[model samples]
Target: MKETVFLTGAGSGIGKAIAKKLSADGYDLVLIGRRLNKLQETATEINRPSECLELDLSLGSQIVTDTVKSWIQDHSENQVIGLVNNAGQFLRSPFGDDQDDWDLLFQVNLMGPVNLTRALWPHFQKNREGRIVNISSNLGQTPVAGTSAYSALKAALDNFTKCLALEGGAFNIRVNSVAPGLVDTPIHDFHQKDDSGSLQLKAALHGMHPLSRMGQAEDIAGAVSYFLNPNNSWTTGAILNVDGGLSLTSKDP
Candidate 1:
């Protein structure tokens, strides 16, 4: 059976980096994302035996679960050994301004992963062997003011990781989470150019990390790879911080 890993958000930024790293490590892929074009680009870049699934996680449990279950059935030949719940939305709204965004965040960031993982549970249980890695955020552990909603959801995901680990242990499934710091991913809008203001902002963010630098996508990917590596099978129920000391700073991004 072909060893395969299903990865959500496998299109750009950190997800793309993770996809590339996993492909290099010899796992065939099932790239899932909201944008088919972007997912296709990632598949082309990796040039591995892979498939793409365009899915909107916020569409509710029935749609997400039904679609993922059907896809798993169709790709049964490729033994799915891992799942990376990396698809998430970031929100930054202060106080009263975030009511609507909170609803959206709960639906997308929290319920999305919840439903998707539930869909994969049966397959993993059947095999009695599987690994799951959640791409959480440093904000979950240490919240910044405007990121209240996002932080709460990520914090919830972290708890879910531990709970899943406890339940999955009987089936030989390991569940872990990687909480990344301020990585120079596409999420931030001001980083697109070398404008003076952007440069200044970067300098401040760098200072937030004791390492005196912003994290690269590869930095977070390395941590994810470590967890996914079969040699570390005994490790589970962990929430690792892959920050450049940014969590320690506890500064607002």
Candidate 2:
């Protein structure tokens, strides 16, 4: 049977890099994202057997369960053993009365992962083997102002990763997380680089890291790959920070 991994947000950024790395390492893929075309692009770049699913992680509950059910039915030839909870949206807090922002953050960032994991738990337990890697953020621990919700949700995810790890041991399932610092992904492309101000901000961000450079998606992908590798099977409940040493300092600008 093909060893397949279901990866959320596999369409781009860190998720895309992770997908590529896993494909190179000999794993089939089930790419999940909101955009079908984007997921197909990732599939087109890989040589191994792969499937793409258009899913919005924020729409938790029965939708998630149903999606998993049909997914299992459709890909019966593949043994799904890994899940990357990388689908998430970023948000800054202190929105005052904007309750929607907080709600959206909770649903997409925390609840979505929870719901999906719960939906997949039965399959993993039945197999008695699986791996889960969550893509979290450094802000979850080293939080700064105006990012309370995002940090808190990620912190919850980190804890959830740990809790699942503890419970999964009985079934030979290992759970871990990769908490990344600033990376040069589309999430950080809010400003036009043509402007001097934006250019200066980007430079400052690069300098903030002790490594004297901004992190690439591949940098974070390497850590996720480490956690997923069967050779490192003993490791579980670990939250590895792939932050280019940014977590070592109190810098964020």
TM-score of each: 0.96, 0.96
Model 1 segments more than 4 A misplaced: 190-196
Clashing pairs in 2: none
In the range 1-253, model 2's lDDT, one tens digit per residue, is 9898888889989989989999998999989989999999999998888899898877877898899878988878989888899988876657585477678989888987888788888999999989999989999889988787888889999999999999999999999999998988887776554577998899899999999998899998888888889999999999998888989999758
Scored against the true structure, residue 134 in model 2 reaches a CA lDDT of 91
Best by lDDT: 1
Candidate 2 matches the true fold with a TM-score of 0.96
lDDT of 2 at 65: 85
Off by over 4 Å in 2: 93-98, 193-196
Error of 2 at 6 (Å): 0.5
